[model samples]
Target: MGDLSGRTALVTGASRGIGRAIAERLAADGARVAVHYGGNEAAAKETVAAIGEERAFAVRADLSTPDAVDTLFARLDEEFDGLDILVNNAAIATSSDFENTTSEEFERIFTVNVQAPFFITQRALSRLRDGGRIVNISSGVTRIAMPEIITYSMTKGALDTFSRTLAQQLGPRGITVNTVAPGIIDTDVNASWLRGNPEAEAAAAARAALGRVGRPEDVADVVAFIASDDARWITADWIDVTGGSDL
Candidate 1:
């Protein structure tokens, strides 16, 4: 059996991008996964099809909504007897001057990026076995301190802090919590504009000392290992999985 054989995992924002990649990797490693999406049901089903019905399940919930958060875990409770891992990967970006940003925008981003994960972890902790794992998908933009992406980076920075404190809290129970920060990943989030845009692509690629943009699998590999027994002793660690990106 693989390291994750027979394990049950829930991955948020799993319709595509890094979240989808994480779901596929865990499934390939033998874990039965619950692929969660906010609104893109079709894309979510596509992910399930790729994983096969036997190894993958699909669930929908807007992470920013309180009711959705509640319903999501309730469904988890109904469908599975236990959960072994959680990959909190759902988030959104709002670009604007600090003064122009709306209160609603702040709430929207924070609710999904920080609040949902907070409550989800709270609600799902009991179902997680003692040896369970939690990996929060954070970003490296906080280090670069980009002005345009300030709010998004702030949310991720909060996630890093959450991983630290939560790991310590869950450590006694043998559940390891950690954060994986990825740099510029080449994904569909901005596929329409980013592709063939030489100036933008080159700018992003230049950030990495490795001199290349990242792939979703790059971050997924880090998450997979963190959820394995090999990382049992690793907790409260905020790991930078960036491709040597500019800091």
Candidate 2:
């Protein structure tokens, strides 16, 4: 049996990109995973198919709405008796820089990225089993200066703080809360600017000490370890999966 055999995990935004990778990895580790998506039902189905129908199912919720947490957990309740892992990997980013970022854009980003995860966790506490794992997907932008995505970085920073504080509170219940921050991952989200553009990709790769761009699996592998029993003693820490970026 795998390290996470018989466990149940909820990976938000698992329809694509890093979230999809994490969902697949967790399923490979023998955890039945709830693949949560914002609106892409087709992509969610693909994720489930990749993980095997028996081991994965898709749940949809537009996290920007106030009742999203309730909606998500209500569906989740129908599938699993309790949750062993909660990966808060759902988030959105805007291209607008600090000067061009309107108040509306800022609010929207914060609502989906920060508020959703906060309320989702609060509601999940009751369903989360003792000795459960909570992994939040943050970004290296929180540490590196990226003014173009300042608002996005701010949301991740808040998430990091949440992980640390929540870890202390949940320790009594044997729940471990930690954040994984990724850098320069080559996913569809970055395809528009980094995929075909060799110069941009080269620049990004050079920033990392490893001299290569990161992949979704790079982050997923770290998350799988963090979610496993081996990481029970590790909590409230920001583990960087950045390929030694800016080091």
Candidate 3:
């Protein structure tokens, strides 16, 4: 419903899962998309193919490294001189109890999930044109509090703060910053247990008021709106794509 013709967007971790869906959606809306991948060149190429290589290209960078972050921007500058929309959707999840989480694990997750995005946005400020949109793909765990991924949740909480603060900081430039938190999505990550297992699938579906597990497209649609000019007034907020879970 939103038009993005002639615009340019970047979607991190877009090789597969929700990120891939977001890339496809933006491309559908007529924005040239750059699909960022950590190390999956094959998957990235596949996504580009799905969106049409002429309209989509793949960029690779290990977000956990600061140098890699710089490299990513450098490559983006070469691929597209300016960016109209940025979706920070790349993240890693780890399951560890409060008593058992290791220092290394904590740092690794934060580096990839939190630190990278923090700097990525910082560096992107120059490349991001005025009136651009910044959409961070946060997680619903921030509100629901699943201890298994407490660290992951904490990272998203920090990202939420970043979004709110950046929204205000960049308002003068007409840039809108927001976060999209998705619930249990039926992606490859969840297919291991949520697919073909009626009991597991039913249990997951019961968690949402919609009585069904979410798909990547559900979140992608919302992101597409936030990226469009239509959502110019919506910022500094978190759009919960949780199917009303725990509500």
| Candidate with the greatest lDDT versus the true structure | 2
How accurate locally is residue 174 in candidate 3, as Cα lDDT from 0 to 100? 98
lDDT, candidate 3, 1-247, per-residue tens: 6899989999999999999999999999999999999998999999999999879999999988869787898789888989999999999955577778899988998999889988989988998999999999998898897887788888899999989999999999999999999999998778888899999999999999999999999999999999998899999989999998988
Each model's backbone clash number: 0, 0, 0
Error of 2 at 9 (Å): 0.5
Which segments of model 1 are wrong by more than 4 Å? none
Quote model 1's TM-score: 0.96
Against the hidden reference, what TM-scores do the models get? Answer: 0.96, 0.98, 0.98
Assess candidate 3 and give its lDDT: 0.92
Local lDDT at 146 for model 1: 76
TM-score of 3: 0.98
Whole-model lDDT values for every prediction: 0.88, 0.94, 0.92
lDDT of 1 by residue, 195-229 (tens): 78998889878888888888999999989999999
